[model samples]
Structure formats: structure tokens, C-alpha cells
Target: MVAEKITQCMKPHGEEGYQTIENMNENHKEISDFAFECVNVGENDKILDIGCGGGVNIEKFLKLTSGNVDGLDYSGVSVNASIRQNQNAVESGRCNVIQADVSDMPIDDESYDLVSAFETIYFWPDIANTFKEVSRIIKPQGQFMIAQGTDGNHPDDELWLSTVEGMSVYTADELEKYLLNAGFKSVKSFKKENDYILIVIAKK
Candidate 1:
């Protein structure tokens, strides 16, 4: 049911026929790139990436920073695929990939300088609990960021949101409210085309 639930939202046609990466590149890359560009990775900052997928984005950080980088995803396929794609980073100890559910990450509290979730949160079964866990794993003044589509952005938005109960195009105000409620000090967002994607920078 867990796989079914999440995959249903990702699949444009059916779960088995879904090619998330391929579909995304066609219509959602601009939004994804926009959010990804906000990372602002300074030297010596520890970074954590939730739902690392195939590690294309994680590789960007690994190449940009000399500091430690880690990623977690619920899908074993995704984690392994990422590991294979970024084997250099893994071999150099600059990056690591783990299989974990967002709501129950294996990382310790205050462990990272930045945490990012790219196209990942809408599938979360409990956003509050996941936010709490992500917040707990960052240091003071550490940040948590998410890259997501806004209303009327991605062509599949309506179907995706419909199949997944809590899935949404989070407004900046709504994101701020939720992040603040989850103990983040601040939250802000931006727009890409019709998509109102959030690049939340929440300080602990």
C-alpha cells in the first residue's frame, strides 16, 4: 500500500508506466532547477538530501562542496541508483546514500548545516512528523529546503494531487505557517512559471 500510494501520485498514466525523471525534465526542470539553485552551499557545510532519487542533484552538491554530504530515500531502487551514479563521491567519502523513510530518518539531531527535499515532500504520509524529523537532524541555524511545483504548474498536478490525499502546491504563506509550526524560524518561497515552488530556508 505504501508503494502503491506514493507511486500512484508519481505516475502520469499508471504506476508501472511512470518515468518520473523523463516526464519531469520535459515540463518541470525549470522549477526544479530554480529551487536547486538556492542551495547556496558554503565551504565546510554538512548537507543532507532527502529522497535523493538517482543522485543527479546530489552530485551537484558533491561537486560543489568539500564537506560531508548524505542522502536518504524510501526507495531502495532510488538509493542504489544514486549510489551507482555518484560512486566517485561515495568512494571519496564526500557523499553517502541511505534507505530511509522521511518521517523516521536515521540521522541524529543537529547533524547537518542544510537539508533539502526535492519533489519529495508531497508523498510524505505525515508532513508534520517528517518536518520535525528533518528539523531535528540539523544544527542550530541549519536550513531545511524543499523543491515542489505550485498550482497549475506541472501538467500532472491535478491527477497527482487528487490521488494523494495530502499532496498540494504549497503557497509561501502556507509553507511559512507549517514550517514555523514545525519549529523553523523562517520560511520563504518563489515562483517558476505557473508553479509556485518553495525554497524554504528554515533556521533551527
Candidate 2:
């Protein structure tokens, strides 16, 4: 029953799912901040945040750039929550939140200066292919940033893996290999001291 509940993190829906997103927004903040520090955000750089969840990160991105920020999530509940969180940006045409899968996005080719995935890729299917899709939407010399709470070496990794359905964790090395295979020109990774936080940046 606990594992089933945990599965809500995969494709959140309903009230429980909504609550899960809210919790994640708060829980993932520190790791997200670490990620922000590793990437450069230009005032006019457009950004697309995958698995935008409650849209808290989108709110932060709006402050960092004068250009638009968009969000994509497969969960409709998450989409609604994100839209609500960034309602003003949406109203002013500064943001668009779409409910769509990572493997097949509706964005135009080379559309963004930066693409980010935060605490979300563990639930992705065929991750390498998804990276290709991410690459497709990023402009040349643009970047893809991935932030995770684990590098597959956390103390509770096994427990979470056993409990959450379809969830997987990868080390920085493994992820780097996949990113390179997906056509990224270069990849750099950072790990927090004495912590499980991992940030990987891939340039196209």
C-alpha cells in the first residue's frame, strides 16, 4: 500500500497527487538551488523546465530571465497546479505549461536556451531517447541540466527503489554516458559534499 502511494510520484493525479507535488516543491528546493548555482542564466535566455510539478522552479526561473519560461509535465494535475502557481506569467504570455510526455514533446526545434529536469527523470522511460528529444528543443550551444536528490548511492536508495514503482536512479557517470550517446557535445557533473545531491549539465 505504501509503495502504491509512492507511485503517485510517477504520474501524479487526484488529491493525493496534488499533495505530493506540493510536498515535492518544498522538499526539492535545496537540490534545485544547488542546480541553479551550477548553470548560467542569461537575462534574455529562454528556458523550458521538464516535469515542472508545482511550478515553484518556474517561478524562480521567471525572476532570473527577462525571456519566457515554459513548463512541461505528463501529469494533468501537475499541469494544473503549475498553471495556478504561475498564473500571472501565463496571463501575460511569459509562460506556458503543457501536459505532455518527455519522449514526445510539442515544442519547436531549437527553441530554448536552457532545458532543466529536476527530481523527475527517475520516472522517465527510455531516458536516452528522451534526452534526444530534449536536445532537439535546445538551441545550439544551449544546455540541459538535471538535478537529482540521489546519485544511486544514497543510504535509502534500496528502500525507495523497492517501494516506488518504475523509479530508477543513475550515477553521474552512467548519466554522462547516456547524455553523450544522445548527442550532447559535453557533460559536466557536480556532487554535493557528504550528500546524495547530483547535478549534471550537458551542452548541445
Candidate 3:
């Protein structure tokens, strides 16, 4: 029951899911901040944030860029929450959020300069296919950033892995291998302190 509840919150479904996403936004601030610091966002670059929960990152991305930012999530609840959170940007046409899965995103080819996935890839059904989709939407030399609180080597990850169905934390090296297999030309990873928090930067 505990695992089921956690999984539901991770993907979120209804009113309760909205609250969970809000909680996640508050809790994930540190990793997100660290991830952004590891890269530079061009003033006029289109960005797509995958698995965008509560639209917090999307809001931040809007402030960081003069160009547009888009968000995609598999959960309708998350989609609604992100829309509500970034209503002003959406109204002004600077941001757009959609309900969709990562493996088959409904975005145009080479449409974005950067793509981000934060604390969400663990739930993707097929990481490889999803990476391919992410690659498709990115322009030449575009970057894909993945930020996670767990680097797959954390001692606590075993507990979460046992409890959470379909949750698979990965090491920076493992992610780098997959990213390269998906057509990314180069990949680099960063660590925050001694914690399991890892940020991967992949260029296509």
C-alpha cells in the first residue's frame, strides 16, 4: 500500500496528486538549483522541460530565457497544476504545458534548444525510447539535462527501489551510456557535495 501510494504521487492522479506535486516542488528545490548552475541558458533559446511537475521549473526557465519554454508530463493532474502555476506565462504565449508521455512526445522536430528531465526519468517506461524522443525535439547541438536526487548508488535507493514499482535509479555512468546510445554526441555528469544528487548534461 505504501508503494502504491508513493507511485501514485510520483505520477499523480487527482486532487491529492496536485498537493503531492506542490510538495515535490518545494522539496526538490536544492537539486534543481544545483542542476541549473551546471549549465548556461541562452537568453533567446527555446526549452522543453519533460516531466514538469507543478510547473515550477517551467516558471524558472521562463525567467531565464527571452524565448519560449514548454512543458510535458504524463499525468493530467501534473499538467493542470503546471498550467495553473504558470497561467500568466501561458496567457502571454511564453509558456505551454501539455499532457503526454515521454516515449511519444507531440512536439515538432528540432523544436527546442534544450530539454530537461528532473527527478522523473525513473518512472519512464522505456528510458531509451524516451531519450530518442527527447533527441528528436532538440535542434542540432542541443543539450539535454537530467537532474536527480538519487545517483542509483545511494544506500537509501535500495529501499525506494524495493518499495516503488517501476522506479529505477541510475548512476551517472549508466545514464551517460544510454544517452550516447540515443545519439547524444557527448555526456558529462556533476555531483552536488557528497550526496547522491547527480546532474547529467548531454549534447546532441
* Candidate 2 to native Cα RMSD, angstroms: 1.4
Weakest 10 consecutive residues of candidate 2 by summed lDDT? 1-10
lDDT of 2 by residue, 1-204 (tens): 333536788999899999999899989989999999888998999999999999999999999999999999999999999999999999999999999999999989999999999999999999989899999999999999999999989999988888887899999999999999999999999998888999999999
lDDT of 1 by residue, 109-152 (tens): 78999888877677676676768888889898888887776533
**lDDT score, candidate 2, position 111:** 99
lDDT of each: 0.72, 0.94, 0.90
In angstroms, the error of model 2 at 160 is 0.9
Residue 110 alpha-carbon offset, candidate 3, angstroms:
0.5
TM-score of each: 0.82, 0.97, 0.96
Q: Which ten residues in a row have the lowest lDDT in candidate 1?
A: 8-17
Candidate 1 is scored at a TM of 0.82
State which candidate has the highest lDDT: 2
lDDT of 3: 0.90
